[model samples]
Target chain A: MSWVVENLDLIGRLTVEHLRQSALPIVLGLLLSIPAGWFAFRFRLTRGVVLTAVGLLYTIPSLALFALLPPLLGISFLSEVNLIVALTIYAVAIMTRFVADALSSVEPSVRQAADAVGYGTWRRFWQVDLPLAGPVVLAGLRVTAVSTISLCTVGILIGIDNLGYLFTNGYQRQIIPEILAGVVAVVVIALLVDWLLVLAGRALMPWTRKGA
Target chain B: MDLFADAIAWIFSPEAQSGSLPLSEAIWTHLAFTFVSVLIAAAVAVPAGWLVGHTGRGREAAVALSGAARAVPSFGLVLLLVLVFGVTHKVGASTTAFVLLAIPPILAGAYSGVEAVERRVVDGARAVGMTSRQVLGKVEIPLGLPLLIGGLRSATLQVVATVTLAGYVGSWGLGFYIVQGIQIRDFAQILGAALVIVVLAVVLDLLFALLERAVVPHGVAARRSAD
Candidate 1:
């Protein structure tokens, strides 16, 4: 407790940095996954290949991916972009499957109804399919957000400097409070973001609200 | 190109093969850690999950617990445990952390797998004069095997990846190279170590996928394909 109090300023800065690193990849991943997921869902021929490939991306360990990315992408070893990019790849890998599954979860009868009412492919997807898939996609996003926040701590190994620093630094200096602070701060950020996402989901998709 | 070239050379170098902690030894240690942790986690989680699933009790709590567990950073957990237990117990501490990390997925898999079995099937087993234990062992367990295996698959992947961090605590594993490389600013060593870990993870994942497939009952496989 004293260790955390004494390092409050450092903790605050690291928490903010941790949020920054995690948020970018999550947003980028959502943006990319929607299109990629749609393509995989809509196109029967490419579905298996695309999903499998993306799924394989997730099997690569985080530390390994963090280490390999800079060289693969021609970035500097310590560049923050490498971490962001690696995290985004992970986000995309995870969310794309969820997105595809969510879209598939939409009833065939609903699509037929949309088509009969003269909704074009683009309009049907935007107005009907997207809305219907929102709940499941949100669920996936929540998982991604929590995992990403937790994973961002790994960036400390490369000297990217985030709450994860507390773990390494605390271990080196034998400051248990510092390590506990990192863990609590990370879990708080994840839960807060998750709660916000739930609120946003309700706000954006009122039809999904309970008893609506 | 030079970085990759250096990494490739380092991977094949005699020093990497004959060092104080040889590459092969690191691989074995990583596997042993992963195996033991996951086995311990499964032993604890599986029955608890089965109890929850079979009796339809404590499920929400179990799920909520697992969800909370997911948000814990594996890195922080390992380091905290090591510090708490002292450096001499680093292996026990990290293994405990790994077991904790592995439990949620296995528990989720176990209960969900059992729950996925049709109510009618269990009822039918009961109608035939089978005992509760018999129904669970024969009906629920067999049907739930695939999902339990799936849970084990994910748990294995998580543990394997995490065991790499044990290197940070001065433990043996491929992560030692990454830790050592980072300290020395040896990009080649880091990359080479990363490549090996990636290969190990992917290969293990594939094996699990195959195992998951093989464990599925023929009737269940046929019914799934029919769907």
Candidate 2:
């Protein structure tokens, strides 16, 4: 449409900023989740409580979280910072569940073999558990990445400028062309990011290519 | 109960009936806005999804489209709509945006449901001389029913939560409480709004669970056991 062609560069810039803000929560969530996941598996009693808490975290509505942030932190991008924190809470909550599920899926024999070789708990985890669980963790990462991207769109509600701004503006004005442009740009970007993650997953764990 | 008392107190407070406090008119309007839009979305999304699933062409493309739909973000969509529609009414913008929010899950569910059915079952039905339409209606649909319901459940919860974003455009929902709460630093109102959302989610989820149980074909569970 004419709207898309006219605003191509503007759309491009909004998409990039959107990606940048979204990346923070995803990267942080993944980093925090991996360790917490490992810790959860190591500590049985705590695992249930942690996973339940994380599950609850996933249910918090995005707009409510955004509004709650401004009072606690003065009205600014710091509110955006809280939004990121809230997203990480949701991501990590879901990630931990996936991580635990993946870990559980590892072959019992392989774990036993690691123990038989006198590998310390940490060493065995790195040598065996992590590699075996890599595919599932990667799948979880993919979900978290996409979910974070989606949630970050809600960031616009709090005055953060992102790709969502374009679409929201277009929709508000009833300019179908601009709204279509925004939708196209977002869909293209999301697919690209998702495919890149899948590629990374395949490259990191070639064994996953074998059908389960 | 204390909770009831608090709710009544919150409802009766000068703040509740005053300016910008969304009361019955607002609640009914929001419910209509949300339920109607979601119904519209389902009407469009469900059959299209079934067709996509049945056809099985462009599976990856369809999935990608759903993901993109999910990523579009409601608030920004409404703001954009306000400019184009030439109307400042928040309800119109919110409804348009919520439709976008509601469609993807249902589409994904229906598509995946159709794909997930066992190939041999399709073949078996055909062997019995069932017409293609009959096979799809009797065999494939029943089998895929559970996943379709799952998708609806997820979609419904998503719409319920995202509908609040319409508040930014001036439509009143529980989100009204959240927005007003923040404007006046009313923590109880904020908490009440949150509690309402959580309760809605749980109740809706439970309702979907019952719907799924009621609707999933008996043969599908039997198939699972046989497998």
Candidate 3:
């Protein structure tokens, strides 16, 4: 506990940087995945190809991607920008499939009812499809957020230090308190991010609630 | 494009193909970690999972545990274990991390697979005076084999990906090539290592799919696909 107090200033900065790196990819992922997901759903050929490609992307280990991305993107290996690009690919890959699945999970009967009422594609998507997909999409976002926070720490090995610096340094110096602080801080961040997403989901889609 | 060609050349090069720490050795180390961790995970999860599914209890707890397990950053877990156990026990730390990563899928798969068996089938077995143990062995497990295999497939892939991180913690599997390549600015070696890992994953996935088909009761397999 005293260790935390002694290092409070360092912790404060790293925590902010950790959240910044993670948040950027998620926001970019959302922008990319929504339109791409919808396009895949709209086209039959893409349905199989896109989902399978994304699954293959997931199979590539995070460290492998961390190594592979720099040259592929023409960025320096140690640059945080390379880390961000890799993470964004991961975020988009995961979120895209979730976007498609969540949208498709809306009942066919409910969609048919909307169509019968003379609703056009644009308004009906907003009123019916997006709202119905809200819960599942939110759930995917929560997973993406937590996993990204954990994964972005891999950047430390490639020389782009974030919160993962704690783990690497603690291990090198054989410092128990710092290691404990690092592990506990990561768990806390994951929980806080998850909770914020849950709250955001509830706020956006009040229709998902049940009255008691 | 040249790096891709070089990676291909690197993979086939004599230095990588055969030496004290050859390509085969690294591949073996990787498979060893995966094989041991997964086998141990199955031994622990399968019986526990079967009992939980049989009683229809602890399913929620199982799901919650798996979710928490997944959220734990596996590389950090490796470091923690190494810190507690010391660097000399890198194998233990890496193996333990792989086991933790492997358990969720197997547990979830086994439980869901057993639960997925139709109640009528089990009841019919019971009506024939088969004991609960016999019913599980004969009816539920066979029916559940499909999902059990599915769980193993997922568990294997996760463990395979994670074993790469084992090298970071000092266990030097195929990930050695990637990490060392990065430090030395050897792009081909990094790509070579990545290519090997990807091929390893694809082969295992294909093997699991074949195993699932072979084990699943034919009619049940058909019904599942129909769904």
Candidate number of the best lDDT: 1
What is the C-alpha lDDT profile of model 1 across B87-203, one tens digit per residue?
899989999999999999999999999999999999999999999999999899889988999999999989987888778887499999998898899888899999999999999
- What's the ranking of the predictions by lDDT, best on top? 1, 3, 2
- DockQ, computed on Cα atoms, for candidate 3: 0.54
Q: What are the iRMS values of all candidates? A: 0.9, 4.7, 1.6
Off by over 4 Å in 2: A1-20, A35-55, A67-78, A104-122, A159-192, A206-212, B1-14, B17-25, B88-90, B183-188, B213-216, B219-227
Prediction 3: B-chain TM-score: 0.93
Q: Candidate 1 at B138: error in angstroms?
A: 1.4
Model 2: per-residue lDDT, tens digit, B89-116?
A: 5556667777777888888888888889
lDDT per residue for candidate 1 within A1-212, as digits (tens), equals 78878889999999998998999999998999999999899899779888888878899888889888887778877779988999899999989999999999999999999999999999998999999999999999998999999889988888899999999999999988889999999999899999999999999999988652
The TM-score measured for candidate 2 stands at 0.78
Question: What lDDT tens digits, residue by residue, belong to model 3 across residues B1-227?
Answer: 77778988989999788754589889998999899999999999888888888888898899887666656777777777887878888788778878887888899999999999888998999999999999989899998988999999889988887888767766368888877776788878888888898888878888997898899787877987999
lDDT of 1 at A23: 91
Q: Is candidate 1 or candidate 2 better by TM-score?
A: 1
Q: Predict model 2's lDDT versus the native.
A: 0.73
Q: Quick one: best TM-score, which candidate?
A: 1
